[model samples]
Target chain A: MDRFERQHILSGFGIESQQKLQNAKVLCIGAGGLGCPILLYLAAAGVGKIGIMDGDVISLSNLNRQVLFGENDLGKPKASVAADYLRNKYSDLEIVEIPEFITTANALEIMSDFDLIIDGTDNFSTRYLVNDGCFLLKKPLVFGAIYEHEGQILVFNSAKAGGTNYRDLYPNPPAATEIPNCNETGVLGVLPGMIGVMMATEVIKVLTGYAESLENKILFFNSLNYQTYTIDFNSNPELKKLIPDTFEAFRAKDYSLSCETIPSVDWDFALSQQNSDSIIVDIREASEMPKLEREEVLYLPMSKLLKESKSLLAAGEVYLFCQSGIRSLKAVTELQKVLPGKSIYSIKGGIAAFLSKQEESNTYGN
Target chain B: METKEQKISVRAFGMIAEKIGSAQIQLIGISTIDELRESLFDQFPDLKNMKFSIAINKQLASGNAPIPADSEIALLPPFSGG
Candidate 1:
């Protein structure tokens, strides 16, 4: 009776699968909710080498979902803490602690050594970076994400033939403002456990060739009702246009930039611009609600601005805004192409934040 | 002759589900992914500002594809949170 006796005696698993697991090298990014379970399972299963890459320190808030840490583990770097915990429990497991954020400068070097890459990150920029890097490095990517009560799991770049990548599903990154991570939306404590276990299962399936790979399909699970659905995806030719052709282009690309939101000026700064030579351009469509009544505001939709950007060349300083700051960020990106060195800013939170502040000020004044 | 309207069941996931206020909904008179998106945006304006993808009959679909009547549709947003 050995450590792997339970899994070894299972119907489809045996010493062969155990050996494969022992020889596999896996890297999990973002040692948070999903990472906790993934690292636990992979290390416990005797993965030859495991890498935990994360730059975040454990906080009290992570306890609900990130099960790897206890109260004493707080304030420690996630990668180091996760590595230390697993190393202590399983001395046979070799864990590499990468206690830094994955950026273009180091993503390729860090990820290239692993045979499989697990994406447990929380931000779109890192998600896209991991996806592209895995594609370039040709490593299998086990992807998992959670929001509120729901979770998504997918395996990308696994099969040699007819496999769909993340870009196939999301041709472009969503506006930063559009993405609401767990920090904002919050997550149920057990949701990541469910999804992370599934991700680990997929990793084993991929490594041992035991089950069919979730290469071209995505699984969506809802904990509220415990309902699960699988969605199939095709490799779109058009999506290739969105991916960079060369490593140089991929490295130079800015994943953080999105048309939906950009650097925005505060309400006070926008107010100051009212008396200055600065121009405020509203980029919302005509049908959109909550119009600003300021006399200095220019009512120009994004469609019109795209066609007639030359109209803005004469302005010394320009401010762009939309209903929720997403379109204005996009407008800033678009306008910068033509306006070059001209001063342009996207009003943060757009009219939504601005109007909320206005109502608050009125209530306080009374 | 007036064509019969198509009705599809839509499942919204992640933040898009929060914005729609329901995990499931019955969408009427929608024949294409593009049309369904327009209807969703019309009903939930905030959805237009968020990033999400549409899956018809459990298959990821481009906006121009024709969706079968009574097909399963899902609005999926990116979930990067671990």
Candidate 2:
């Protein structure tokens, strides 16, 4: 009896489908929660070549959702451990362990070798990087993301015509500080299992042409309520403008850095310039808490600044901040467009980091 | 004749839900997606700084599309975790 005898016996999935799966080369980025299930299913399904890339080590905390590791696996690099586990289980399955993190410098090169890419990363910067690299490489990307109790899965840039890419769905990456990962918000242990399996299902469907693909649709599932929704997204030609058109341009881009359009100043630097000629603009909305009581701070919300562009025209060397650094970066981008050549910088980590630093230093009164 | 006020049911997910303090919200007098967003920003000011997409009746909406009466609106922020 063959190892794939059970699956091959299923209707419409025979030797041909199994052979297609065997010939398929899939690359899964991030060996954590989503990657664990995705890699497990793909390897069990007998994918010919599987590449697991992650720069993180297996920690005790990750065992709750990252099923690929155990107590003995702690302190081991996730990529190698996951690869070894899969390889030891299946001798024929070729698992490549890449212990390095994916960055713009190596994303395109590494992704170009695979037939399909899976994004299981936990940050906006890497998500965008993977999306852009897959788009450029013209490989179908199976994307999975999870929050507290909900998960989202999508298959982008497939061979199907009219297929939408990640950029079409999200033209801009959300600010890094705005969206908290499972580490911060906390996710149910089973959420990633459900989402990752869904992604692996998409990978199989795309590889074997066994079923309809989610080429332009995003499946959003909430485990808490057991409610699932599929939202259709259309390809936007304008979104391509955000991506680099050539490999040279892509190589020149910085994927590890978020919000590169504007310059950023650390909390220490921002504090040093507090009483200097640099004007401090609080871009957070009026209702947000942890207000800066300093007399030198300017309470100008982004909405007001957009409506009244002339208010900041006379202000020299403007510094922007918000709850997180994201809104402030957006403010810098907007202000730079109108006031070209002006020195505009967003305070890194925004007021949240600044307040924490103040508390640490016991300088709230100052 | 007395005019009836229009109200739309809103559902927020992930960080947007945290900011709104509830998974569900009610926006009154909002006739379009943009209006609903503005109303949400006014009620939950922190939403202005966050990035999210709006969906109406299970379809991702763009621009100032008119909101259907008693529409099921969903505010979805990006989910970065795996």
Each candidate's DockQ: 0.62, 0.54
For model 1, what is the error of residue A28's alpha carbon versus the real structure, in angstroms, after optimal superposition? Answer: 0.4
DockQ-based class of model 2: medium
Can you tell me which runs of candidate 1 are displaced by over 4 Å?
A160-163, A259-261, A264-366
For every candidate, the chain B TM-score is 0.92, 0.90
**Model 2: per-residue lDDT, tens digit, A1-366?**
789998899899898999999999999999989999999999999999999998766767788889989889876788999999999999987889987677677788899888999999877778888888888888899999998888999888888735477777678886554555444456777999999999999999999988797878888888989888787777888878898888888888865447555699987887687666777888866645557788878888776876776777776678888754666766787788888888888897667567556655785555
Please, what are the lDDT tens digits per residue for candidate 1 over residues A217-302?
Answer: 89998898999989988777777667777788878876654543355676689779677678888887664445678888888888
Give the root-mean-square deviation of each candidate in angstroms.
11.9, 11.0
Off by over 4 Å in 2: A161-163, A257-366, B1-4
**Residue pair clashes in candidate 2:** none
Proportion of true contacts reproduced by candidate 2: 0.82
Candidate 1 yields a Cα-based lDDT of 0.82
